[model samples]
Target: MSYFKEDFKYDLTSSIVVFLVALPLCLGIALASEAPLISGLISGIIGGIIIGFFSKSSLSVSGPAAGLVVIVLDNVEALGGYEPFLVAVSLAGLLQLILGFAKAGIIGLYFPTSVIRGMLAAIGLILILKQIPHLVGFDSDAFGEMEFFQADGNNTFSAIIASLENFNNGSFVIGIICLGLLVLWESKYIKGVKALKQIPGSVLAVAIGLILNQIFISSGSALAIGKEHLVSIPILSGEGGLTAALKFPDFSAFSNYQTYVTTITLAIVASLETLLSIEAVDKLDPHKRHTPKNAELKAQGIGNFVSGLIGGLPITAVIVRSSANLDSGAKTKMSAIMHGIWLLLAVAFFPTFMNQIPLASLAAILIVVGWKLTKPSIYKKLLAVGQQQFIPFVVTILAILFTDLLIGIIIGLVVGIFYILRANYKVPYNYSTGEFKTDDGREAIKIELSEHVSFLNKARLQTTLDGLPNGCHVMIDGSRSKEIEFDAMEVIEEFRINAPERDIVVSVKDLPGGKGRMA
Candidate 1:
């Protein structure tokens, strides 16, 4: 009971913040994918409520992801319509279910810590850069796009430039005021007061934006924010309201080859994105709780299945929503589930009120979230960790800033692997010279093999053997090793065979294949 009371208080407020952040994104991503506007809402509802209910992650918020926009657009067109695409989405969900049962979620465990941190920082940078235009009331591009290159022919930097040229005064003022309010709310002084801390800055920002715009209108001022800069959800009417907005999948598409191909693509991409999002959210969780990856995949599979049946876009664990949830102090999955309930109720009963919300207010909230993610202190900390970590971390951030999320992660992994291999190359074995000599008084060289030597150690082991002094007694010890690769053993064998050519004496000890001296 105590846990529920404490968690509910935080969850209630966090849900409202997540709902506001998710509303525009759902619509914008659907618009970008060329799907029915209501489809996004349907997917968001399923992701938040159903996925949240089933997911092991308390902090991760699932939704229709911006990452799938391009894939969805192309497949929807190639498959000849939205209904057929829904068919593919359903099949994809089935595939995801199979993958989860097969424990494919273990794939996420392979991502290095540096790469994961880099991904977080890169996303933060993207949010700050991409939200700038919306902050200033320039809404030419979609709301949730994180890719460097946009569908509107503007890159991230170019969009910022364009926003400056097309700023709206009313949006500028509201955004500035909201941003200031949020900053003030987060200050130590405000947090010191119990009363002030309970008041969420995001809600205050929304209220202020609405009231300021209304004041502008009542005074007949030109600075009034127009409907174009506000949230625009499709309101349900009294008659046939639910049925009119909902779409159903065309099951006949199951026989189509293109549908199968699209299913495979969606399954792979959505599962990967879902895994990454959950991983990222787990990193951001204040409690540092670990989420079961396989459970998350199963939850996402169910979400996509329900979404597709109702003619919704495919669903995945979205990092933007998940991060927003975490930053807002969500303590349990209840926050996500409540956000979905709010989305449903808003569409059914209160869309007009919701539509009054200015995009700038939401943009302000996201800007703060982004800042928290890519703070300079994080960079300094990573740098302090050393180059092996810092290099890949920096590389991942730059790569993501220039490309899409998956591509950037792949690039970071490549850099990380190179460092791993280089480290292995430099330290294959422990080489030392003993002052005590053999019976004949020749200087003795000793090479102690590592516990698990692989093929990566072959070259260095060979080099060490070749550098042995002539007429020296050398000892290669593997008695302490757990396993030695064929490559390293071959190098030792070859060196022993040719040792007499240089008047060198070779003695091999307790190696796996053989037990005694090859002198």
Candidate 2:
């Protein structure tokens, strides 16, 4: 109780900021997913109210994620219709719950820090590149679409070029002005002011954008923004309108095998995305608090089950909204919950007003957020960490830029694992050739095996034994090892058996199957 009250003011302010950020995203993800616009709103609402309430996460904002847009679209088409697809989503939620209870969430802990950082950096770059089209009033692609190859005919760079060719001067002006205000709002002077500090810059930028467009309209200026340049939130007029807008799940589809396949697909993808986002969100947390991964999965399961049961798209913890929440000064889960409440209220009562705000303004805000995420300092810091870390970090960023999030992450993970193997391959044991006392006081070459030797060390171990000088006395020691892999032990045994052929004296101590001197 005190937790909510202590940060109520900050949380309220941040909730409004997140609401402004999330509104277009909800619509855009819906647009990208080919799901009904109201369904997006429903997911956002459930993500906020239900997931936010149940989630242990302090800053993560769950909603219909952009990552699942393609998956949702294809499954809907494959399953014959949106109604049947809803059954898959609900079943996916059940699978997520099973996963949580099974403690599968620990998989998130294995993601290399460099890969996670790269994911965030890639998303930052995507946010900047993708939002440019919106900023210029080229609204062909949906707002939340983040893939390299968009559902629209154009790719990321091509979209920017296309937007430049057919740019809207009004949108450009609003975006530029709003961007300037956001930058200025962060200046030392504005931040130092007590009265201004409480108010969020994004709110002011959005407000000014509205006023600027209205002023242009009043004067009948050529710079007046058009409906195409503004937000397009659907208004729910009454109960009939609500019913007409939402489509329910076809429960009968549960018996279909394809439905189960789609359910498994959604559960896996959504779980991975959620786990990744949770990692990134925790990294961004100023307080450095940890979110229990299992708890988050359960919360997402509930959110998805409720969303699909009613008529919403699939849900996941989204990094963009979470980053926006952090940038907006959110202090607790209240901001997330309140954002959902605000989404519900705004759509129900003020859809017309929301529709008036220019998309350009929101684009400007996201651009700033994007820049913060992929700042130059981050690149420099990772570079200083060494190539092992930096390579995967950069690879993840580029992969995500050229591909979608999951593909990029998988690619990055592979690269990261390769580095891990390379590192392990380099030093399997300590090799020292010196005049030392063997068990009876004779000079011998000493080979101290590493604590845990795997099969990867077999080849190197064999090569070392093969290179030993003929008739040289050698000591292969494993007394300190906790576990030696069978493959590595085979190399030791083979060397011991063959030592007599080379007239070499070999001593094996504390090793499996070979613990005595070899003549």
Clash count list over all predictions: 0, 0
Cα-based RMSD of candidate 2: 2.0
TM-score of each: 0.96, 0.95
Worst 10 residues of 1 by lDDT: 428-437
Q: What is the per-residue lDDT of model 2 for residues 291-334, given as tens digits with 9 covering 90 to 100?
A: 99999999999999999999999999999999999999989998
Reference-based lDDT, residue 423, model 1: 87
Please state every model's RMSD to the true fold in angstroms.
1.6, 2.0
In model 2, the runs with Cα more than 4 Å from the true position are 435-443, 509-519
At residue 316, give the lDDT of candidate 2: 98
Q: Give candidate 1's whole-model lDDT.
A: 0.90
How high a TM-score does candidate 1 get? Answer: 0.96
| Cα error, candidate 2, residue 242 (Å) | 0.8
Scored by CA lDDT, what does every candidate get? 0.90, 0.92
